[model samples]
Target: MYNALMGTAATTAVGAGLTLYYLEKNSAHANMEAEGLHPADYPFPQKKLFGTFDHASIRRGFQVFKEVCSACHSLDLVHWRNLVDVAYTEDEVREMAEEFEYTDGPDDKGEMFERPGKLTDPIPRPYANEEAARAANAGALPPDLSLITKARHGGVDYIYALLTGYCDPPAGVEVREGLNYNPYFPGGAIAMAQNIFDGVVEYEDGTPNTASQIAKDVVTFLNWAAEPELDDRKKIGAKALLLFSSLTLMALWIKRNRWHTLKSRKIAFNSPKNWNKKPNPPSKN
Candidate 1:
């Protein structure tokens, strides 16, 4: 009895302690009701159920990423070869890959060497490591944007808002030093300042290089980066849907037309009434 009572008391104490700890953590995190604003529901044409990414926008987004975001953020998951025929041609990717030198293996003399970046190599990192990245960015690590669209809650829309939402903090809002105000971000302060602006990048397609346009294109590119096979996936999904629908209809028709009689027919069982007496009568006849 004592052991059971002690166990019960211990469990209750642990539960109470956990509850208190969670409550304190929640209070710390939920200081303000305004955690962040919902991202704008911009009607991206490529986000359509059966739609594809805009390749032109993807190219522009690549341009934006290279010229702007690449300075701090690294696209570690992507390879130079992956961009070929998706955003840029093979020749272009080859040329772009050649622009960055990569560290190669030691020679016969046991010396490391530098070689041009190959298409197969992962995209160059901005910093050598996390420590260096943090040191450069005032101890704030710039996140790799390879899968950022899928990693975040609101996906690309959230990113777009974040990119364009930087502004002066409202009254009573105190953004600390080294932080910038963006209502779209949780806690309303982010390490990444407003990077996009009007004419920040010149679009080869002649799209006006407004801040919003830049944000949109980059967001699109990030989304594509997150899911490079989106177009192929959509195509496969449509084909699969059609195939399954046809199979389902065919199955229903076969059940209705071919197996209709077998499925619908009812069997009646008759009890032998005069069998015993009939056998005796037949023998007499």
Candidate 2:
């Protein structure tokens, strides 16, 4: 009876496994055949152990964001002063801030008025509020980009893919009127359209501004914005590790030195035969 029950259980398990295998195979085939969806090539920046931001790329990315993405996305966590020596010089940052007018005071007249932005001011938003932003973008709210690179699954690669992934829907797939097809996006449809193109922004450093280059640079900038203190953190960690390692070596040396006598000491034991040699004592008696 037990043998029969075991056979029944094995048969059921094999059937279930076959069913799952076929289902997974069919799903993979469907994904491969789907239009406008393809696995993105991983970016080089993520491959290194001590991967650092490409500052020039980051600067170009900031330009793209400032000119294009700022129309939709808000970078609320970033401050003008934070740009100093990172993306822009202090003088350049100040000048950039002066271009935007921010609502400053409700002073003597108890009414608010616009004033030129200062170094301490946050980046200005295109919309006054979330409602306004949504209304402008046909009810789709653009996400804040402060931590976007870290928030998404593939990090920089995802952003770069999404930016460059726009394409026509496959023959069998039906794309809704407003939604665009992007294979890299989870649902294979995205609300945001392709924003980057060749010569979208001229680089001051003479780097060719291709579509891929723009996407990569903007992604780099966003990554930096997501973690501005990355360089400092790495530096501090490296220093701490060095100090700890040096101290550990010193401690090991001290320990070995302290135990040297005990480790090197030798002892000799006399045999019982030697103890029996009491002739000198007997002669004295």
Candidate 3:
């Protein structure tokens, strides 16, 4: 009776616990449904297992960044030299770097000097400091675009969604005057307004300047900025897989051939008397 009672009590407790868990989970999910929408699952080609980035799109993206995003957002981590081979040729990168002036070290006269930017210099910040950045944008400091994709929750997809997801608020929803409506953002409102629009930036390569295209290109560029080693990393991973796969096959073949002989070999004990019988007889004689 004691054991039976204990078992029944445990079963009841377990059932009650499971019931509470199910109720809470369902409630949370329903709340989310009422709150806002998740980011769309964009079909980014470079996200594939073996897919590579479209360099043309990346180049166009760089152009978009310079003309549009550069005004507010900063690309502090990426250097001008990184553009070489990936988006721009060496000479083009050199010229582009020279366009931006950089502050140099103190001269022999003990005064700082300004000089043309070099390939080694990092992308410059638009605002001199965080306070200035916030003051300009109504207390919103623009995040650096260096690793924006990796830093965000849904990565590139989330950013792209936020850029293009601006729309009128849903019924019964009241947005603040300054904040813009973006369902992809938390609480369905964001400080930064929708910036990307049709014909925001022109592409030298003759790509269409549509809003979607511009956002796609810029996101691709930022993704590349976040992970510049992506191409080389993928190539190395493929080569390693190929090399190890070939070696694995060779090993299995050798193992099967050699181990077959070992596993199938016979072992028998010989009677000592057979080899020693004649010697014993001679010794007795």
Report each candidate's C-alpha RMSD, comma-separated, in the order given.
Answer: 9.9, 8.3, 7.0
* Residue-level error in angstroms, candidate 3, position 228: 0.4
Return the TM-score for each candidate structure: 0.82, 0.78, 0.84
Tens-place lDDT per residue, model 3, 39-119, is 667888889888788899899999888888888899989999999999989999999999989999889998999999888
The order by descending TM-score is: 3, 1, 2
lDDT of each: 0.89, 0.84, 0.88
Ten-residue stretch with the least lDDT total in model 2: 32-41
Candidate 3 — worst ten consecutive residues by lDDT sum?
25-34
lDDT at 150, model 1? 91
Candidate 3 similarity to native, TM-score: 0.84
Candidate 2 residue pairs that clash: 37-183
Candidate with the larger TM-score of 2 and 3: 3
Better of 1 and 2 by TM-score: 1
What residue pairs are clashing in model 1? Answer: none
> Ten consecutive residues with minimal summed lDDT in candidate 1?
24-33
lDDT digits (tens) for residues 1-285 of candidate 1: 999999999999999999998665444344442667767667887778998999999999999999999999999889999999998999999999999999988988999999998889988988999999999999999999999999997788788888988889989989899999998788888898789999999998899999999999999999999999999999999999999999999999998899989988999999788756644354544
Candidate 1 ranges beyond 4 A from true positions = 1-34, 266-285
